[model samples]
Target: MRVLHIDTGLEWRGGQRQALTLHKGLLSHNIESLFLGNQAGELHQLCKNNHEEKYAGFAFNGELSLTTHHEIQNIVKEFKPTIIHCHDSHSAKLGSRFHKSCTIFHTRRVSYPIKFLSRYFKYKNIDAHVCVSEDIRNYMKQHFSNTFTIHSCVDIKRFDRVVNKTIFDKNGDINIVYVGAFSNQKGVDVLIKAFSNLAKKYNNIVLHLIGNGELLQPMKTLAKALEIDHNIVFYGARKDVEDFYLNSDYVVCPSVSGEGSSGVIKEGMAAGKIVITSDLTANKELIDDGINGVMFKTGDSNALTMSLTKVINKEIVIDHQKIKEKVSLFDCSNTIEQYITLYKKISNK
Candidate 1:
């Protein structure tokens, strides 16, 4: 069976990454797959390099542009895929134009509430809805039907062959890494504040903020203001994140919002590192507090500081093997099999 994947995200976020993973997995299984993304986006560039003929590009500026719709429609006519999988909001909107012609499957990766109008029409047009988290699926079930919950997965092999290298001075320092966007939703400021407090008591601890966003400068200034700038390393958007993940003592996700099945948590667990994340619904689904990973109160820096102290002092012990085994179930191979089953089911209908 053939599938066409559409993603219009400008940045290479979790959704875009999942789309790429799914596309690669499909090709490995000898399933025909095509990708369409923003021409200027990072995903498009990666797809162009890896799968030139299977990749298509268009310029998208958030809103549903007529030109993009026309281009996608023409491609759909030419490709005639069994399933049109929309990976982001913009692409879902674009895919809505051809719902009547083919099976449109939209993957919801966020936990935000859906508008009544959009749910009744645009989302309703979708043949099957795939949610990255059960929380998202529960939220969307009220307005949509034939929904499936498929957690966002990672290629476990990518973390298996990681070459360990120090990103910071390892002078018996307990290094912690955060691998996501430096934005408000990600709660980078919360992590910085927590680290600032932790640094006062434990001078040997270090925090590595390893992604770029609007709040990068602001978070740096906050670190300086808190007098813990020396304890924090702001690594702005590195392609080689596995090195950082491998060398770190722990991985933290302090997101206050917009997290639907965190890839960081799964990747950290797959790497056999202790992952501490916000105690949100999505996070709680993956972590069994103090077993595989730890959880802190969302947006609470003091709680985060306490959680860090527990790990640093050996007050909390994590089973590295158990964590790795738990995460193995969400590997890209399993995720691809689930999607292929769904694709075949929808195609038959």
Candidate 2:
């Protein structure tokens, strides 16, 4: 089956990664797939370097302009894909314009509820609505009829091949890593506060803040104000995140808002590291409390501090093997199989 995946995001976030991974997975299975994204986007550059033959570019100005509409029409006519998968809001808007001629499937990666009529209409035009988490599906199901929940998957082999390099001091400093956008929704402030408290108690603790966003400088400022800037290292956005996952003692996802099954959680589990995440509906679905990973109260700095202390003091034991086994279900192969099934179902109709 031929598929066309479109994403208008300028940055390479979890959703963009998923789209690229899915395109690669589809190609491996001998299913023709192409990725169309912003010409100046990070995803476009990465895809051009890796999957150069299958990558397509368009000049997107964030909104649905006449140029974007013309480009979509040209691509649809040229590719003639059996399925057109929209990976973001902007792409979904463009996909909706061609819903009558082709099967349009939108993957909702965020858990935020759709309250606007225009947004609801855009979704209504989609042939199938695939949600990355149950929390997202629950929100979309209320308005759309063909909503399906498919959790995001990671390329586990990438994590497995990471060379374990020593990132921390040899004096046994507990290195904690947080890999996500530096935004209020991701609860960067809460993580900083929690890390500040932990750093005051233990001098051997360090927090590595990876990824970048509009709130990056603000988060760094907060670390300085807390007087824990020395304990936190801001890596901005790095391509070699597997190294951070491999060397860290723990991975933390301190999101205040609900996530659509965070890729950070899956990546940590795939690396066999203990992931400490906020206790939300979607997070609870992946983590079984103290079993595979641990969860703290959402947006609560004290709760995060306590969870961190548990790991530092050896109060919590992590079963690396069990974490790997649990994370296997979300492998990219399994996600591809499900998507193939969905594609067949839609194509038959």
Candidate 3:
């Protein structure tokens, strides 16, 4: 099947990663795929190696721009894809124009903000909605009455265990890793405070934060105020995430809002590293509390601290194989096939 994936986001966040994975999956399956987005962004660069044609980045706001309709129409006429699987709301609305001739599947990557009548008007043409988790699926169903739940697939082998674990390497100090943006929704401040508490209990503890955001300096300031500045290391938005996961002993996520089955959680699990995430629906789907990983109350520094202490003290017995097995269900190949199934189903209608 031929598919054209469209997204306007420029940041190299989870959404972009998922999109790239989908593109690659389609290619690996011998299905034609193309990506449309801001031409100058990372998505364009990432698509450089793929043997696929990328259309020019159009000047259109994701939420409100229909000005690029003529250009999109031209591209669709030229490519003639069987399905226009829009990866974001902007692409979905744009794809709505060609819905009569081709299947248009709107992949809802996040929980879109809806304010009364505005939402009522925003979803008039989307044929089907795809959500990453049950929580998000249920949420959309409650609001729109039409949505499908599919777990975000991951590469299981990419992060599987490479070597057997030795003794708790307590001599080099416990390494804590945070792999998300430095944003308010990430609850970075809560992590800083929790790290401070854990540091007081154990002198040889350090936190390595990966990724950057608007609140990077503010979170750094919070660490200093809590007197844990010396124990923190900011790697600032990295592409070599697997290397960091391999080196770290534990991974922590402190997001307080806007999460749907985080890719980071799956990555940490696939890499066989223990995880401590917030008590949110997205996180709960991955962590089985004292089994695969642990959970802490969202935005609660004390709970984060205690969870960290348990991980550091070897209180959580993380089964390496079991954690790795969970990632199998999310194989990108299966995810693409599911999309293909949906595409065929929708197109025939």
Candidate 4:
């Protein structure tokens, strides 16, 4: 069966990555697939550089664009996909517009509760709601029917190759890495405060932050103000993420707000590194509190500082094998299989 994946994100975040990966995976399985997405972002460049033949960098304009509506109608008529998978909110709404042509599936990654009034009609055309985490599904179940959990997965093969990058020049410094957007939701501020407290007593400590957003400058200012600028390194959205993971002794995801799941936690654990995250319900599903990883009170810098201290002081240790084995359950290949099965199951009816 043919499938069309629509992702409207202008940035190459975890959701876009998953959509692209799934499209590629379906093509490899001899299933017809096409990715219709924003012409902007690293995703657009990657598609052009590698798989232009299967990509459509559609400029959907905006939510109320008549041009976008007309274009989508034409695409649905010509492509006639059995399934249309919307990867973000904007595309989800757009996909719903032509639900009569094909089954609609929306991947909900956001964790915020929906408005009570809009909940009923928001996902009206969606045949299924594919949530990235169980916690997300549980919350979404209250707002929509046919919600299912499918964790956004990592490609384990990504860690197989060496990046040959130096993260630290020091002999035995403990390198900690945080790979995510620098936003209040991601808790970059909390991480800075915690790392500052950690760095005060530990000279051999280093924190590597990758990814960029509006908060980049603010977090940098906070780091300097906290007197931990020397111990902090900002790599700002590196393609060689595995390189940082390879060099890091620990991975920290200090998200203050809830989300579906974290790519950082998945990739870090997939690389067999201990992940330290906030005690969000979704995070708890992955981290077993100092077993596979460590969890601290959400938005609490003191708690995070203590959590980091445990790792640096040798008070916390994890079996890398256990970490790899756990995250392997979420390998991208497995997620592909699950999606294929779901697509066939729904399309048959």
Candidate 5:
């Protein structure tokens, strides 16, 4: 089967990563697939020779230009895809205009602004909507009324377990790491505050932040004001995050806003590193609460601090490999096969 995947993005993140992984998996399954996205996008360069691109903007603003729609139709005609999978609402709307021959599926990867009109409009275009987590699915169903939940996945092999069981040497400091963009939604400030408290107790604890964002300077200032600046290491925009996961004792994700499914937590689990995340729907989906990983109340620095302390004191027995294994059920191979099944069913209609 021939498939066309569309992403309305520029900067690479979890959603884009999933799309790329799915593309690669489809290729392995002997399915011909084509990827379309911004020409300058990170995923654009990863596409095969059959892939096409439409660089709408650096950011998707929900606007659909006629020229863009015309280009999509041209690509659709040339590729003759059996199915068109739109990765976001922006691309879904554009694909809706030419939705005749191909079966189209839209993947709702986040709990967003939740605009009433747009939700209704989104319900109108795509044949089926796939959400990355049950929490995201529940949110969409409440607002939009129809959506399917397909848990987000990771490349298990890429996040292979670290062989060296040697204790991570942070010079007697316990290393706490956070991997993601420096955004307010990620609650970097909350993490810094909580870590500051942990620092007051365990002077040998360090916080390592990987990735860059708009909130970097403010978070750094917050760390400085909290007097834990010396205890924190900000490795901005790291490409090699696996090494960070391997060398760290634990990972923290204190998100205050929308999170479909944290790829960071999965990667950490895959790397056999303990994780402490917020009690958000997305995070809860993966953590079995004191089983695989620990979850603290979202936005509660005290709760986050307590959870971190528990993890450090050996009160929590986190089976990082077991936690990692749960995500395999949502692996790219299985997810793509689900899409193929859906496409066949829809096309038969």
Candidate 6:
């Protein structure tokens, strides 16, 4: 069966990583797979670097772009793919426009609710709804059927590299790395407050903030205001997150909202580092209370501070073996197989 993957993103994030992984996996399985995405995106660059005509990258800004729509139409006409896999909301909307020609599968990465009319208009033509987390799947099932849970997986092989500690090297006696966009949804402010409180008790510990967003400056300002800027190192954005993950003692996914199967938790678990995340409904699927991961109240800085304190004091021990075993079940290999099975199941019909 032929598959056309649509992921028009401007950055290299978990969704783009998953799209690239699936595209490569499909090719490895001898499936005729093609990709279309933003011309400037890392995902498109990766595809282009392969020097394959099966991939197409455009200057896609949004679903309203006429050029992007025409390019997708031309690709559809030429590729004649049996399955059209949309990797984000914009791509889903654009892909849905061609529902009559091919089956549309949209993957939702967040668990945020879509209103009834908006949801229907968005998903009415979608043949399948692929959720990156079980929480997202359950939520989508309330609005539509044919929903599936496929965890946002990490390639364990990617973390198998030798960490040189050259970029984003570890700092302080205890290093806790936070890798994600700096935003209110990611709870960067709460993380800063919690880290400041944690700092009051420990001087040798450090909080490494990675990734950049509009809230980055604000978070930095907040850290300085809290008199903890010296302890908190803002690395902005780095491609060598795996090395940071490897060299750190813990990975913190301090998300207060908008999480569907955290990539930080998965990558951290794969690297054998202890993951401390907020106790969101989806995060609970990846973390258990005082088990594989440490969790705190969703938005409570005090709860997060206490959780980190417990982790620091060895009050809650993370079993490396247990984490490895649990995370292996959601490896990229399994994720690709699940998608292939779903594609075959729907394509055959």
Q: RMSD (Cα, Å) of candidate 6?
A: 1.7
Cα TM-score of candidate 3: 0.91
Give the per-residue lDDT digits (tens) of candidate 5, residues 1-349: 7878888776778889898777777777778888777666765654534353322222333456666676777888888887788887777887666567777788888877667777667547577778888888887777655477777787767766554444333433688889999987899988998988999899678888888989999998999898888888888876677778877889898899888888887887877777889998778888888888889999999999999988888887777567767767766667778876766776677
Q: Return the TM-score for each candidate structure.
A: 0.96, 0.95, 0.91, 0.96, 0.90, 0.95
Clashing pairs in 6: none
Candidate 6 accuracy as TM-score: 0.95
Q: What would the TM-score be for candidate 5 when compared with the true structure?
A: 0.90
For residues 1-349, what per-residue lDDT tens digits would candidate 2 score against the true structure?
7899999998988988899888888888899998898998998888778856688899897555898889888999999887889998888888878877788999999888775875656676889999988888888877878999888998889886847586543313688998999877899999999998998798778889889999999998999999988788888888889988888889999998858989999999988899999998999888989889999999999999999899779899878777988899999999999999999998788
- lDDT of candidate 1 vs native? 0.86
Model 1, 92-194: lDDT tens digits are 7788777777788999999988777787666767888999999898988887778999899988888878475755544236889999998778998889889
Query: What are the Cα lDDT values of the candidates?
Result: 0.86, 0.87, 0.77, 0.86, 0.78, 0.87
lDDT of 1 at 160: 74
Pick by lDDT: 1 or 5, better one: 1
- Rank list by lDDT: 6, 2, 1, 4, 5, 3
Encode model 6's per-residue lDDT on 158-269: one tens digit a residue: 8998786755444688888899998789998988999999888986888998899989998989999999988988998888888889989888888988999999899999
- TM accuracy, model 1: 0.96
lDDT of 1 at 216: 92
Point out where model 2 deviates above 4 Å: 162-172
Give Cα distance to truth, residue 222, candidate 3, Å. 0.7
Judged by lDDT relative to the true structure, which candidate is superior, 1 or 3? Answer: 1
Please give, for residues 122-190, the per-residue lDDT of candidate 3 as tens digits: 566677788898878877887776688777877766655554333122323688888898887888889
